[model samples]
Target: MPHLLPDTGPQRTLAASNFTYTVGSGLFLTAGVLYFTQAVHLPAAQVGLGLGIAGFFSLAVGIAVGRLADTRGARGVYATTLVIQALATACFIGADSFWPFVLAVCTATAAKAAGLAARSPLIRHYGGDRPQEFRGYLRAVTNVGISLGALLAGWIVQVGTLTAYQLLIIGNAIAFAASAAILVLLPPVEPEPAVDSPRWIALRDRPYLVLTVLDGVMAIQFKVLTVAIPLWIVEATTAPPWLISGTMLLNTVLVIALQVRAGRNVDSPVAGAGAYRRSGMAFLLSCALVSLSAGTPAWAAGTLLLTAVLIHTIGELWHSAAGFEVSFGLAPKHATGQYLGVFGLGAGLAEALGPALLISACITWGRPGWYVVGALFAVTGLAAPLAVRWAQRRQQAGKGHTASRQPPRRICQTSPP
Candidate 1:
């Protein structure tokens, strides 16, 4: 735990910012939907539709915003996103109708996505020699903060009052504002030296795009614990329904305790690809365990489900670490934000589409679906190394071309969240 602490002032500041941001995220994630459906008295379908529309719109905003961050400045752009997110969240209380709800959600979601891309440069600059490792530390901090916020949200949900939910909204907004405020403590990070490249090079980079698609597919595994596992426990397995919360608690604890440790050794792009393969295999095994729990006795079912969650969480750590390495290690220094923004498109799509895909494959289709999903992950994992190698080769080719024109310098920047 001591080793996991951020060593530098910048790292500490960034970690503090991440912690505050995720705490607010946890609050909203745990209870925001309920606030809309119950406190706002909006229809559930309308809320879902609005969120879906917002998610779709956000996918297109990240690249442009990220490019803005690169040209203008990361800290300012990032702070702007946080302020916009705060404002949009505060507007939630005023959203009575579907259109107003859509407006607020769309603005907030776009800001959130844009913030992630905009902050990439800061992570790269402050992360020192191994930004991926610092990302792991931040992930650990994020899990801890989110867990605390979730506990608070649980109280709000238990209170079950309009005022309590409204308070949750206000608290969430304050958290975002506070997160932005913390960023002021860190020194500003200037944009990297510009390179001669295409206006939208990330979009044109086929190998990187291939890697992005593969990573996006693997990202579906993220929804398994949040969406499929809980639904499976209730609809299929005879495990006590209480295990749903228990499983989530277990996952949170493991992530907070072990995320940095698990990612410590996966330091390079090649290593990250290997981690992806290992993660896929772990997910496959966990899925099998989950599928077997369906027809078991209560105790046996509970055991299998718990075991599955443990394996799944481990895979999640590896998957996250791999993504950080490959995304950061492969991006050009000058276009870190734009490349990461492009990288985010895949995850954005997965976030929007993963739940439906998981439901259809893991729940609607039953046990066979779990196997199908597992196999898909395994195959995706198997393919990652190849994609990474292709990216490496392309990177080398670009480096060679650049060297012919001028003195050689490190072109592949190594950092991002």
Candidate 2:
């Protein structure tokens, strides 16, 4: 079968750019906090607090950048942010104190926010016909690139020297620069023409707002693997420490294999809603498996943990499929950049605060935390369909009003003989 974006020059360019940049990101992101605390000799609490705050504040910048993309063209916005990100990411090496580190991280965070704001709209524009599926292929390709970079980073970390860490940082910074060069080589994408006053329409959109907030909640499921799973494995479950690596590998493999296929069937908001519903159920089951690992025998616990990872991977695939659909489908066509920027808030918030929330739930509350989080996903997923329907109705009603306000065309009258 033909690939979704096969033989299309711009789409391939987009995919290549995504892969290149993700590889750069994976190198630094996999060990950012560790580098800050261990190599820089900063206090762990300060480092965590700094990054958490930087990430949180970065959320607000997305909308502003989105506006820029809408007015200034996604290609230019994307390229500019890539260069800013490259510089910011490299500056991490110069920060020896809390304030400097905070400044560098915040700059990188802001650049990242803007890059995301531009990337989606660019994809939507270049996707031509099927945007969501194009996004899925991008996700799969990006994951593969990230996996390769992570492998390289892991090997560098094994070298166990400050120089190696510096090398990793420098390498990632260069990769960002390379990605920007690729974007520069591509043909430019023109900005959408101004429609009415160029204000933030996404803010005024209530149903879209509600749906985005729900996506924020559901996205926390990802944090379970990144932040919670390893901690839980050591503290609660009897699974071996090495199983943590295994679980991460499993997730990467599953996403690369299944993401495109999972998104293949999603053509409408309704289908997207169903995808979310399925994702919710998978999350619920995964959490249940995870909870049951506590107090079990080592063998049983290991089995339970792997099973949980498998189910969680399935949920991740479904969630990605739905996320793209809901974001694009709900957006007003003229204001895709702004709407996507607003939608990016949900994901940004999840990354910013999910660790604390997951820790409180899983560590402070124990197995019941998993249950609570699972139920949260279920509820959010269940609400998705209704929210999408509500937003769709608003679109229809607006179209109807526009039609009603237009003057009727006069028919020619026949002359009497």
Candidate 3:
């Protein structure tokens, strides 16, 4: 049996971290289900548009809040954002009209983005040098929470009406509030600011820019798998609706089961680069598998979809684990939030563009649209090994430069907290 508790640090801190992530995931999953339910009542294009709007707002506000966390301390920012998220969740419950729903989604998106920005940096703060493992553990715990939320929502939908959606929104509010309370119990650790750390100026850094771009390319898969795949299954196959739900459950279960081991393996000096390379390759393979759906017989399409989902879930695990480690490792201590916020921009853009891209591809290529997505993934995947090599050389050069110019500094004891 897998151990429920992490082996590092004080149990209190680990428990608190797990609790906070659980709450955050619950909010996200709940909001996502509610958003889809609302979207079902509107036109197809409207769904994409609404999500795009939310992503845009989230990207804009998340950057600002990330800067705040870097300068002011993550605890304060996390607590404040969680409060905002709770309010936004409550707003969703009250939102009956289209405009109201839009407004609520926008607010919730921003709140969640900001909260995540603050929370991620804090996780590193607490994990110190071993952030890779800590982040992996964090992801696993959060995935468990997300899985629970998804499962609960599914059950509620079966036994209840749309009103169950309201209850989920309310539950999300409570979860955010609970996270805020937990964050309050942690000690404050303020990060120093970088010189001339304006948001636009930060973008001028080449390495950061490259990482962001790479991440953006990866984001396309995220958006499609999460949104378009379910729709495709429903429209093109005889798969039971629960197949999609099962796929998600499988993803969460795998993360929870293997994330710690994956994190450790990925962080090894010999395997780290290989792990990064494989993430992209796995993603491409999964996309290709999904594309095969276009050629599947109707009688066999359900099995094909299930198989595709399994491949995609494995890709998710590899990419997500590596992505977190790389993001945290590449960031400078003083600019954690700023860099992370920029990293998050890729996700925002993906969420905004993924649905539109899928729709456009379908219109232009019909069933072969899946192939187009697969081709994109393949190209990106092929670039991964090259990117990893570049990042490694850059890090080595940076280390050499820093060693050559030994600056006077106080004794530093670096641990998560």
Clash pairs, candidate 3, are: 125-416, 126-416, 127-416, 128-416
Output the worst ten-in-a-row residue range by lDDT, candidate 2.
Answer: 1-10
For candidate 1, the per-residue lDDT at 166 reads 92
Q: lDDT tens string, model 1, 1-417?
A: 465579899899888888899889999999999999988889899999999999999997899888888888899999999999999999999999999999999999999999999998888889999988888898899888888899999999999999999999999999999999999999998887777888888899999999989999999998999999999999998899999999999999998888888887999999999999999999999999999999899999999999999999999999999999999999988898999999999899999999999999999999999999999999999999999999999999999988899965879977997
Q: Tell me the deviation in Å of residue 64 in model 1.
A: 1.3
Each candidate's clash count: 0, 0, 4
Off by over 4 Å in 2: 1-5, 410-417
Best by lDDT: 1
Ranking by lDDT: 1, 2, 3
Q: Tens-digit lDDT track for model 2 on 257-350?
A: 8888999898889999998999999999999899999999989998999999999999999899999998998886667778888998998899
- Cα distance off (Å), candidate 2, residue 373: 0.9
Off-target runs (Cα >4 Å) in candidate 3 are 1-4, 8-48, 159-163, 193-201, 238-241, 268-273, 294-299, 362-367, 388-417
What are the models' TM-scores?
A: 0.96, 0.96, 0.83
lDDT of each: 0.92, 0.87, 0.68
Worst 10 residues of 1 by lDDT: 1-10
Off by over 4 Å in 1: 1-4, 407-417
Error of 3 at 139 (Å): 1.2
